[model samples]
Target chain A: MIKWVDVYKAFGEKKVLDGFTLDVHEGEAVVIIGYSGAGKSVAIKHVVGLLEPDRGTVEVDDNDVPTLPRKELYELRAHIGYVFQFAALFDSMTIGDNVAMGLRKRGEMSESDIAHRVAEALELVDLPDVQHQYPAELSGGMRKRVGIARAVALRPKYILYDEPTTGLDPVTSAVIDELMIRMREKLGVTSVVITHDMRSAYRVGSRIAMLYDGRVRQVGTVEEIQHTKDPIVRQFIEGRATLEGDAASLAAPGPAFESGATARGGGAE
Target chain B: MNVIEATGRWVRFRVEEAGRAGRFLEEAALAFGSVRSWLPNATLQMRRLGVDSLPIGLLIAVFTGIVLALLASYSFTGAVPLYFVGTLVEKTITLELAPVLTGLALAGRVGANIAAELGTMRVTEQVDALETLAYDPDSYLVVPRVVAGTIMFPLIVGVAMIVGLGAGWLASIGLLHLSSDEFLKGARMFFSTFDVEYGLVKAGSFGFAVTLIGCYKGLRARGGAEGVGNAATQAVVYSAVMILVLDAFWAMTWLHGRS
Candidate 1:
């Protein structure tokens, strides 16, 4: 299980996450949805020890992520896979090498074993027989699949996807969504996907969590989130702008809203 | 801002930058504790940073040798023997020109390339990807380049020294109207093994500085294309400036008591 408890993180004056909290139990997919710059990515980054929360705890299997020693952190990370938004493929390396990176780092597998696993992972992502190609030669969708292949090459127990389908065409996005679902079902891996695409959230998420104004606004199944009565939730899902009076009221001075107000005021002046 | 406030900000920026550089160096040193994973990359970088640089380095050394010989001939007009021009060329190339000039040239070539490559990776999140993959970015990305630079520079400088002396001898014999025997005698007159060793030491130190500064600038790059461009430019400029500074310091300290 992965749990973020009252996570507070700020970059300069911009409080990206304030008392944000969420939990993902074993063997389930929980997609966190939020608008751009809403800290969805930041929240997932904490799970992988990529970013540390300033004032709260991030725990994976009850191991404190931020305070873990280097060796222990690396050991923990070996069991988790992170897929980046841009694929983040090592351009200089061949696709095969890119997929094999994590496996090679473990230093326990033979060369032929690593090669066999790379082929298997690529086949799982439906990207068979492009091992010799470089990332620059692959299409965006293919690169994203290669990124996924790289992540799953180690057969990690958990996978974190950061905006996995953000820039791809709708058809390609659907393909990626299907791959995410398939990976979870087949591997029994706990999955956390961070994305703003509502369609993708509904497609891949067993449960959807909405992040807003620095904290989780709601957590529910896809059907529950679609019919949620909360105006903020409704406004986001419907992609509708807040009415002027409602916007002003929502922006009113309050402790829960202080960071947003300060950030906007500072940006304006 | 007021003048005092501006000065304070500048000081703070410099101090912060120094602290960052210190920390980066520490991490790079720690990376050496795990050299097995980085060895293959280090060899590949040696080809890129050292082997590919050979022709340009040699060309520069040859021309510098001819120029130094020509200038020395002008100084040896009447009283001094024309052959001493050979000694001057030999000593100057071995002690100063070959290593220092080669380092400056590579600061522009290798340093800029390292910075640009790493800066692009930073912007594209490749370094973050490595970290996420449970790989140490310092060991995987940085140590290889630094190790290549430190190891290859002296070898490059050795080639530069030999080619430079040979070109200087040819130039002296042809342009200065001196015999081969006279030039060879002058070249061998005051040859000390120490001068060559000191030059290689300088070469190695300069290589480390160039690569470390390049990696530092690249890794710290933020924003986007503009930041990458800035990092590349700063890598070359800073590496060159540091090479000159190290040159002066080496002269004062390493060569002071011995000379």
Candidate 2:
């Protein structure tokens, strides 16, 4: 389980995360939906120790992420896979090398074992024949799949996706969404998906949490969020442009619970 | 009051930036402990940063040798013997010109390359991906470039030294009216093994500084295209300046005591 407790982070004067909190239990997919600058990516980054919180603790399986030593932190990270917003594939490397990079670095697995795993991962992502190609040769959607293959090759216990469907067309976005679902079903890995795509959220998430003003505006099942009574959550889910008066009110905090180990907020807190 | 406040803030920013760079160096030093992680990459980097840089180094050395020979003969018209031109070329090429000129040239090429590559990776989040995969960015990305620069520079300088001297010797014979024996005699007259050693030392230090500064500037790049551009520019500018600084430092520390 990954737990972010009252996490507060800022870059200079811009407070990207303030009192942000979420809990991702094992064997389930939790999607964090938020506005463009609502700190969705920042919150997920804390999971892999990419960005440290200014105030608060991020714990994974009872280990405090911030306080862990270098060896321990890296050990903790090996069990977690993070798919980047832009795929972030190493352009210099071929697809096979990119997929095999993490396993090769661990130095425990033999070359044949690593190759087998890499081949299996690419096959899982429906990219079986592109191992010899570089990332520059692939399309945006293909590169994203390779990124997923790279992560999945590690066989991590948890996978974090950052805006996995942000830039793709509807068809490509749906393809990535299916890949996410397949990873969950096939690998049984816990997932924390950060995205504002409502369709993706509904499709992939067992629980969807709305982040606004660096806090969870509402957390509920897909059915509940689909028919939420909260004006802010409703406006976001419906993709409605807010009027001035509604915008002012929407900026205010909601009554959702700040954070909890179980479902927190909108009566769950 | 506002001017004073702004000035103070600027100074504080520089101090803090320096502190951060120092800390980055410390981390890079620690990253060297992971030999297996960086060794293969270092060999590849050696080829890219050193062997590939040879043509340019030779090109610059050839022109510089011709110019030094011409200038030496011009200045030695009557007062000094023609052979002193050989002595002057040998000393200047060995002690000052070879390492300093080649380092500055490579600071523009290799330094900018390192900075631009790493900066692109930074903006693209490849470095973050490496970290999430439990690979140390410092070990996987930084140490190879730093190690390549530190080791290959002296070797490149050694070749450049020989090529430059050979060019000068040819110029002394072809352009001036001196024979091979006279030029060779003058060349060997005042030569000490320390001259070559001093040049190699400076070249090695130059290599280390150029790549280190490049890696440092590259990894800290922010934003997008503009950030990468700024990092490449800063890498070139800072490493060029560092080359000159290290040149003077080595000259003062080693040559001043010897003289």
Off by over 4 Å in 2: A243-269
Model 1, range B177-253, lDDT digits (tens) per residue? 78999988888898899889989999999999999999999988888899999999999999999999999999999
Pairs of colliding residues, candidate 2: A257-A265
Task: Provide per-model DockQ scores.
Answer: 0.81, 0.83
Expressed as tens digits, the lDDT of each residue in A143-183 for candidate 1 is: 99999999999899999999999889999899899999999
Model 1 / residue B36 / CA error / Å: 1.0
Give per-residue CA lDDT, model 2, range A90-141, as digits (tens): 9999999999989987888999999999999999878999999999999998
The stretch of ten residues in a row with the least summed lDDT in candidate 1 chain B is B76-85
Q: Residue pairs in steric clash, candidate 1?
A: none
